[model samples]
Target: MTGWCRRVRRFVSGRHPPVPSLLFAAAWAYGVTGLFAALDPLAARWRPGGGTAVAAVTVFLDLLLMRALDDVRDLEHDRRFHPERPLPAGAVRVRDLVVLYAAGSSAVIALNAAWSWRAAVLAAQLAYGAAVLAAHRRWRWPPGDRLLVNLLVSLPAPVLLHAYLYAGYLDASGHGAGWSGAVAVVVAVLAAGYTELAKKITRAPRPGEPAATGPLGLNGSVAVALAAPALSAGLLAARSQAPSAWTPAALLAMVIPAVAGCRFLLGRARRPCAAPALHLLLTFAGYAALGLAR
Candidate 1:
């Protein structure tokens, strides 16, 4: 009902303004594990329990934590240019976000420790958080630092998911090719790097000053950048499964969202009315692309 309350809700939970939806990203991440493992020949041996579930839980938490921090870091800047956001509008308590993020991070690592080897993947991803903080504090910059953080963090999500899946397959069926699985996981890392770059160059706002809302900046380009990998990965995944026929359909599925995401990213700021649906679509494209990479 009130302005501040609306902003806070928008920041912490909603689909527009303050940020994209972390919850959606986490749920999509679960799909990354499911699809990769299901397609693996080792899927026969891949059990649902063991460290695999633990890894899934950790990855989900990590997505939430990282996404929250990104908003926290951008609070001041967004408020100046985009006041509808929770931090800028005073709807969400910025100080409280740290505690929330920490709790999630702790829980993720604890679950990861149960799986031992899998924990390494989590730590690798978590380390990127610290790196981002350092870059922000030490360098007083954003998109570049943000890009590095994205690539670093992205590497682990799919790789770890694949690892857990492949690990289970090895344990149960003893049939998985460890090296081949590792290579597929690496492809995911590369795809994330591309997404990071897209986010960096597209629709990007000026770091300190907000640009008048327009379609030419970092964010807009990012909307398109998200397309590159989503398109490629969808085709690859379809090729893996259907080769001739299904591949085109899969590629189409990937492209349609990308086009919709671009449409949203370009139009949402003006419409505000259509923002939630658009942001949700953008988040879906991002997560699906990552999952497709796996």
Candidate 2:
């Protein structure tokens, strides 16, 4: 039992440090919810409340669950290419993660159920996650070695998470944003994709490592990374009632990733991993500020 506890501690500390992970989840919850409320005509004066708090907690736990499942799903690959990771390095056992996942998922469901019909949305996300896990484990669908294919298959999870947040906001405010909610989802997904691609842009990937640079090459990967955020910012500005006010902030937020890409192209040895994270932080913070101001 003590050994298991130690492993769990090591895994959590290494893979999902609580403070930063919780902060990221909270930012995502508030930022996405705020953006949706602002975009939706019916959600005037929508303020963060108990529902938003619940959503933040739910997102934090759900993200942890996703991390556990992903680590398990990629165990074999990690053993080959990322043996330093917790699971591959024997710092944590699969059953330890299973226990953590079960506890975290139960908390998420209970929190959602107590709050609103957001429980249904949460359930759908969980079901989809389970289905994907099963497909990977049982049928080996979308071959594990194919990074782009796996990415496409996994992209819907974030979209569903964004939808779940929107649903929670609606439940709290008793108002719907009509088409703006859908647009918000698209914007959020694009931001997520941009971050994912940006972090993995490399000229030389380790043997069997799944990176966008593998198929797209360094320049092509960087281009796509730059493009996703630009398109996302454009969509966000187009959807905003005050595009003139918001467009500049969005563009400014984008400069981080652009500069990172430029430095990377100039033959920087270390990847600018921090750039994508900063871009996300700035963009989301800007959106949340704009939404709350309105």
Candidate 3:
């Protein structure tokens, strides 16, 4: 048990930091349920504890699988560019990671299966992940194409999460998230993409190093991030069900990255720093609160 715990720690340290991962998963649970509440309050009404557990587990497993796959795929690149990373540094073996991945997959399947037929949602996520990994193995896109690649890779994430929640909610409440739920899903996807772009904004790359997402500079990244909230606000407004719930969050979402972008522009900071990510975490909380508020 001790050895197993140690390995788990290594995995967390090496792949996903524990604090951020847990926080992100918690926020996601709230946001997903909150969106469900907004779209269909009656449908969203269900046993809180069970719903929370399902969302937390689904998000955590999704993140874990993504990190593991990325680590595995980028083993060589990490060895060269990020030598201190666990897999490249020889702190953990690929075999161990594979075992963990398999175990995680099983757990995800079982959790979703028990929750509902929603295990199929996780299965779709797994399928997309596998396809991306296969592509990475075959043709490594140039760094210039990194932005597009990142977007494509992440596009399915919101769908999977939504499907997971939607399926479970249906099973529990015998109703669906409705059309507004689609808007929430779009908002989630755009938020994720924006965060991806924000993280890749580099304050300073070495002489030979390119911008993290190729040619996308601070301004472009910020713009990408800003677009999410603007669109989300519009969607929330159109729904008219709980505009109050999402309005502030949408505005704040736009503001956080915008402020970070300005700082990056003025040379006050390098990259968007952690502002965009932190904002995303807050947005999740806001959405969750909005759900509960309703």
On TM-score, the leading prediction is: 2
Model 1, stretches more than 4 Å misplaced? 1-11, 14-27, 38-56, 91-94, 143-183, 186-227, 234-249, 261-294
Model 2 residue 293 lDDT?
62
Which ten residues in a row are the worst by lDDT in model 1? 241-250
Q: Residue 150 CA error for candidate 1 (Å)?
A: 7.0
Q: lDDT of model 1 at residue 4? A: 45
Q: For model 1, what is the error of residue 13's alpha carbon versus the real structure, in angstroms, after optimal superposition? A: 3.8
State the local distance difference test value for candidate 2: 0.79
CA deviation > 4 Å runs, candidate 3:
1-8, 41-47, 141-145, 213-218, 243-246
- Alpha-carbon lDDT of model 1: 0.49
Superposed on all Cα atoms, the candidates' RMSDs to the truth, in angstroms, are: 7.1, 2.1, 2.9
Instruction: Give the winner by lDDT: 1 or 2.
Output: 2
User: In candidate 3, residue 13 scores what lDDT?
Assistant: 82
lDDT of 3 by residue, 1-294 (tens): 566557667877867887778778877876766766665645444345676776786788778877887787778767767888888887777767766777888888887676446788788887777677767777864233376666666677667867777666566567655676676777666666667676666666655555664555656665766676667656654553454645565455666766777777778546545786787776676566556555
The total number of steric clashes, by the backbone 3 Å criterion, in model 1 comes to: 13
Sort order, lDDT high to low: 2, 3, 1
Clashes of each: 13, 0, 0
Residue by residue across 58-119, what tens digits does model 2's lDDT show? 88889888998899888888899788999999989999988877777777888777655577
